[model samples]
Target: MSTPLDIASLIDRERIRPFQWTIFLLCFATTLFDGFDTQAIAYTGPAIVAAFNLAPGDLAPILIAGTLGMTIGAMTLGLVGDRVGRRPALLGGVALFSIASLATAFASGTSQILVLRFIAGLGMGGCTPVLLALAAEYGPARHRGAIMTGVLLGLPAGAMLGGLLAARMMPVIGWEGVFVIGGAAPLALLVLLWFALPESLHFLVTRAGNDQHAVRHVLARIVTWPLADDARFAVHEAAARASVAALFREGNARNTVAIWAVYFFNWIAWFMFLSWLPTVLKASGLPAAQAPLGTVVVNAVFIVCAIPLSIALPRISTRRLLIALLALGIAIAIGLAYAETSWGLVFTLAGAAGLGIGGQQIALNYLVVGAYPTTLRATATGWAIGMGRVGAIAGSAVGGTFLNMGGPGGFYLTLAVPLAAALLAVIAIRTNEPEAGTSLATAAH
Candidate 1:
């Protein structure tokens, strides 16, 4: 009788292969486009305001609409990923966003823009957690943290790229052209994903109803050893039924709740900064032409720090690292509250804030992906992100309100509260180390 082969151990024991790198690159590309489209509206906000003859504050509803859709998408498609497969769920998300973004180019008014952005958000929200799940599963156990972080870097990189493109493209092609580019790139990427993306091997073996032959074929590509026709395959990790409830099972409840809290509070500060910083900078006497660059600074700094942080994650304590990063964000928020409105001072603070906020966001995502088993990974990550999107909705709305009520000082000061809460939430989490695929037997006991 053939013995059962553990899929996770099989990957851990092998050298990194080209097949894995291809998956990483594909995931990176998907996230890159997701970032571009997600932030496209922000970059194009001023132009949209001008085009529609609307007040700056009117953008809040549009922002909220998108995030609300993202919340729904994250929760819904995340479950879909667990039920069907990560590849199909990811592809569906990309297709949804691509089509929505293309439609945004032709939008005639705020209502239409709101609708299009919401639809685009659905795709954005849905694909993100699934992509992270796929990337983490494909990555080796020893380097999973770094690999996941590298894949996630595409988000900020894409956003930074959007900022650069918007600065140049908006001048020549207008906001419509920016949307057109945003929509088109992902549509092209969608085609590539449909053809090139592979299903997660973890999912193939662990999930019911998958073809055994297909699993063997994928396994053969990753490993040099030949598999017998009757060789049994398994993922040693605890299996949960394909449902959201699985997130709370197998000693995951507290970790799940804490993760959601961290995501919720962190995103309140994160999206508030992302959604309003450009406009806030403009209001604080920065040039209209340069306001969007503030966001670029944040994302650029984030991209710069990602690799080093990723490299450090496995070597350090994740909980302590997360808490320290949140503390840094709190400090930056306080600094921003008192800093003068000069571009030099504000931009300097923005970069520092990126280090704190961006680092925490990436690390938290890494933690979530690593904390749960393969069965619950996508759902847990998605729900956490979905909760964060809800916070993002609040952040967008609160940003406008705060700006109108007390200006930049009040807005920046308020951010510190959420960062502090997130710090506490991080402290509350019980599972802070990389799980690296705990065995079912180990987990149960």
Candidate 2:
């Protein structure tokens, strides 16, 4: 008689293997480049404006194009991952962005830049949810939250790298050189992914065209076991077809709506701060050269704190932690409005706020990925991130208006509204338990 093996149990039971680490690292690298390219336009924005002799508002279309593309890509390509495969979807997205970034270097007009950026956004946006799903699937349940957050940390790290490279390389080779490097690095990574990146074992088994041979090969590497030709593999989760409506079925409706709400409002506050903080800092008496440091401090603090936060995620309730983080952000936003013009005070407050908002964003990823079955993981994560991208667009669009109406104090005060709403949404989530080691199969049913 052939022996039956549960794929989820096999992954959960094994010690962390080198193969799994490789997957995590690759996913991390992908996100790192994703961040770099995503922010490439921002880093190059001034250069583009100067190069083209364009009006101030002319760049808005170029900026918004990429984000708009990302929103659509996340919602649609995420479904592609569910139906086709993670490996292919990821490869395709990387290819799309790489080519787009490379092409951006050759653009002659603002129109060309706008279209190329939108195309690049599609790839970057699609990759986020798929990579998250891929990394989470490979990770052992005990360490899943840490692995996902670790991968996500690359976004900020890459953004920081883009800033450094833009400062250094633009001086040497000019702005076009920045895009050239961004496009080339990922093209190199694409070759490695083709050779080394494996399709998700869970995806292989659960997908309609089950590829048992591929599953056995990947399983052997992870488990280091010899398997019989007659051996059978299965996932313990309840059957779920990959579809948008499936997100609302199977008792998932409440969690889905709440997760979407949290993502939407949290990003509204986040992008608002990211978009306008430098201007706000400058207006509050800081020099233009030093103003950008406030944003850097925020990202750096979050990157540093991510380590301990990841450690604590498995031990505590993600829901409660997220709520606390949002509350902290709310308080900090209010405090920021009343803070003195001292640079030290402003940077300090910004860092503290980054800890709260940035930490909450990662915790939301941990919560959402664990809430769905293997079949719907990519789709669910994709849609939530897509919704967040929409919120980002909204925040970025309205930030100028807020600054005009309220100045620094008003801008900061307005930020608190979104954080408060996000806190309420998180509080409404009914699944309050730590998701580690729990079978989502049972939870879904």
Model 2 scores a TM of 0.81
Off by over 4 Å in 1: 202-208, 229-232, 241-262, 314-323, 365-386, 421-445
Candidate 1, residues 58-111, lDDT tens digits: the string is 888998988888878877897899888899999999999999999999998899
Query: What TM-score does model 1 achieve against the real structure?
Result: 0.85
Worst 10 residues of 2 by lDDT: 436-445
Per-residue lDDT tens digits for candidate 2, residues 1-445, read 6667888788888888998899999999999999888877766765676689864345566767887888878877779998889999999999999999999998888899889999999999899878988888887776776677789889878776776676556757677888998899999999999999999777898894678888988988888667778988987765554799999999889889988999999998887676566556656776544554565677778888888876776667888888889989988888899995866777798999778777776577667755666677657876887788889888766665676677788889999998989988888777646456543222222
Q: Among these predicted structures, which one has the highest TM-score? A: 1
Give the C-alpha miss distance for residue 78 in model 2, angstroms.
2.5
* Alpha-carbon TM-score of each model against the true structure: 0.85, 0.81
**Candidate 2 lDDT:** 0.79
Q: List the residue pairs that clash in candidate 1.
A: none
Model 1: lDDT of residue 305: 86
Q: What is the lDDT of residue 368 in candidate 1?
A: 66
